[model samples]
Target: MNLDFPTVMLIAAVITGMIWALDAWLWAPARREVAARKTASGGVSKADLKELNKEPVLVEYARSFFPIIIIVLVLRSFLVEPFRIPSGSMIPTLMVGDFILVNKFVYGIRLPVINKKIIDMGKPQRGDVAVFRYPKDPSVDYIKRVVGLPGDRIGYFNKTIYVNGKPVPQEIIGPYFQDEHPLSQSAELRIERLGNGEHQIVVEPGASLVEGQYIVPEGHYFMMGDNRDRSNDSRFWGVVPEENLVGKAFMVWMSWQWDQGGVIWDRIGESIQ
Candidate 1:
């Protein structure tokens, strides 16, 4: 089953909080009163009175878990959240098994589970690496680079990108090799300047090219992966709506390519470009 983590967390928090609150408001007070009456009557033993005064296991567990769940939910929803990279669509910039940290509030503070934006903090830039809910499938999360802002014309022809009729410049670096894909070997490394910043992208010269132009709609953004030819992005599906945005990926906390090696120590704590 595809379980929604945020929803699960929210439900758990609510249940625990309610249980704790109920015990404090009604059950605990009733238990204390019973204990006082027993002490005054002097018929009940001290051990029995102590047992009667003790809290139920469920309430105790609820009290212990409520605060921790709330803290985690707040941190994940409004502060920062961790995500694992499952594919190489962002090759040369992000690896296949990189665990990245996304700044949740950078885009805006959204309500958990429902993901409705409650505060407007900022919008995405052209060159930003963003994580968002897939437009076609809202349950699936996708990460890609912002290529076109709202109302901008974006075109991809001959492996070059044109933004608003101006060509985005690219400088060839060298031949690129991916350890994960040993069978495919026609990729090259290049530095692409999208807006104000530059990032490395992997382009396959021999791969079949799908060229097209698009005008970004208002309240929507065009996204393309750094692995230009290999990525399944806006070119294949559609632009990401403003409401689908999750956050901007800022850093890689851990990297582990299990098929190649165990842990990639060098990639740890590296900031995402």
Candidate 2:
């Protein structure tokens, strides 16, 4: 079964917040009043009342974390959601272990859990690194760079990108670092200049070019990973429909290389362009 994390977070936040509020407003007040009455009647000593009136540690912790968790969940579902990079599909620009933030309402405002878009905000533009639900499997989310909008011709050949019968400019950068790993040694860095902006990309020169030409259909977009040689994107699966779009990734909040040990402090607060 595919677990819906946002739903789980929303439910947990509600349940915990309610429990905390109930304890604070109703149960705690009543308990304190009872203790005070007992003390006034001389049935309970001051020391005994003090001990009895103390809230449980678990309850105190729940009360504190409830509001914080609720705020985070709401912000994540409605404003921006944090996601960690799991693969090298967007290498050179977004490396594995990079934690990025996606703007939740960029494409449109959608109700959580139901995934029903209720507001029309804006369309995906060229050079955007977007996160979206996989068309083949709605439960799965995938990330890639937007290359073709609706009704545009997109072609990939010889490890180069062509849009609307014109080639997008790609300038070779220095050799990409391997980071003490065997798999990372295969790529070379290049910078792609799109209409909106410029970003880094990785390409494997000797790798076979999986060539294809696609005419983007209505309400759909053609997407490609920055790592041209190591990505399975629109060329392999298909174009992403408008409804499948989740959000536009706009920043890198954190990055941690587990093999290298500890947090990559430099990557924090870096804007995604």
Candidate 3:
């Protein structure tokens, strides 16, 4: 219902690849042989023979593109898949154009179209960045930092985060640059320490608390964006169910900013922390 562009592209690639394979292995070869025999006996004109030759053009293109599509689909559904940041939700850590790679099998390997989990690999760890289907709208994908696991109590007040009744430490680092949003014109860069992991985050002083305490239900997790002031995550829409878990975001493979034309080489190979 709420199918996004990526899902549609993947489906298209699969359908096209199947058609191509069928033609090559079953139909096209037979048709070609028939045409060849007709040509040898002078039963068909040159123009008709030319048209017959073009019958395999679609198959050829499909065969060529099948490998590329399969590679992407396998990587995206079972290994590591790349994604681009579209909003300021993960600002300090991931910019609007920052491209990231998510480890698809970290949680489990699921079939792409059906999204049915076929294996149990790992569970979400505290302080990990993750991608998942929006609980309210399954077709929409979202990325966020995992803060609370199942049965964990997460609290947010006065712009600070508290997990399991303990306060998470945050230290001011420096001023953050504003890009794509006017509200970020004067933001503070801060390092937030969660459990044993530390990550950079952006905060706006004197900003109101957008979310409050929540008890993460079983089989669900609480998530938040690094850009505390901008993300609409579990705090607003509710926890992400275990079934919605897609993958753990692990690295930035590439970045493309319309303002900056070609590849953003500097951001490449940067690990997701």
Candidate 4:
């Protein structure tokens, strides 16, 4: 089953908070009053009074966990959230097993679970590494570089990108090869300048890929993976709606190489472009 984590957390926080409040407002007071009456009548020992005032195990647990759950929910929903890169779609920029921090409020502030935007803070900019719900499947989160904003024309032809009839500048940085990554060894590393910033992109020479001009609709964005040909992006599916945006990925807090079975220490603390 596709578990909705945000919804689960919200539910847990509500249940725990209610239980704690109810116990304090109703149950605990009733217990103390009964204990006081018993002691005044000399019908209860100290041990009996203590037992009567004791809280239920469920209430105690609720009190302990309520604070923690509420904090996590608030931070994750409005501030920042951690995400694990699960695919090589963003390869060189964001590797598989890389744990990244996404700035939740960069694009806007949205409510938890339902993700309804309540405040406008900023908009996604071109060249930003973004995490968003997949247009084809909203249940899954996909990370990609913002290649085209709303109403912008994006073109991909022969491993090169064209923005508004102008070929985007690309400087070949020579061949890219990872000792443990056999599939990426043949790809060419290049610096592609998009918008006002530049980031590295990997493209296979002579590799056939989906090439065409795409016009981004209003309130939608075109996204592309840095791993050019290997990524499933707007070229294949469609533009990501503004509501599907999750956050802007800003840093790689941890990286684990599954194939090598070791931590990639160098990638840790690396800032995402």
The best candidate in terms of lDDT = 1
Candidate 1: regions farther than 4 A off: none
Off by over 4 Å in 2: 17-66, 181-187
Candidate 2: residue 9 lDDT (0-100): 76
Give the whole-model CA lDDT for all candidates, comma-separated.
Answer: 0.93, 0.86, 0.85, 0.92
**lDDT tens digits, residue span 1-273, model 2:** 566888887777777777788888988998899898887888787688987798777677878888888787768777899899888888767878999999999888898778898988999999999999989998888999999999999988887889999999999877776753334455678889987799998888877868989999999999999888889899999999998999999999999998878688988888887
Deviation of model 4 at 99, angstroms = 0.4
lDDT of 3: 0.85
Clashes of each: 0, 0, 0, 0
Q: Which tens-of-lDDT digit does each residue in 4-68 have in candidate 1?
A: 98899999999999999999999999999989988898889878988998999999999999999
Q: 1-273 in candidate 3: lDDT tens per residue?
A: 566545776886978888887997878888898889888888798889878767566777787787888777777778887788888799778877888888989898898878889999989999999999899988778999999999999999867899988889999988887544446556888999986699999888757658579999999999999989888988888899999998998889888777667677888998989
C-alpha-based local distance difference test score of model 1: 0.93
Question: 271 in model 4: Cα distance from truth in Å?
Answer: 0.2
Model 1 TM-score relative to the real fold: 0.97
TM-score of 4: 0.97
Can you give the lDDT of residue 265 in candidate 3? 88
C-alpha TM-scores of all predictions: 0.97, 0.81, 0.82, 0.97
Once model 1 is optimally superposed onto the true structure by TM-score, how far is the C-alpha of residue 202 displaced, in angstroms?
0.7
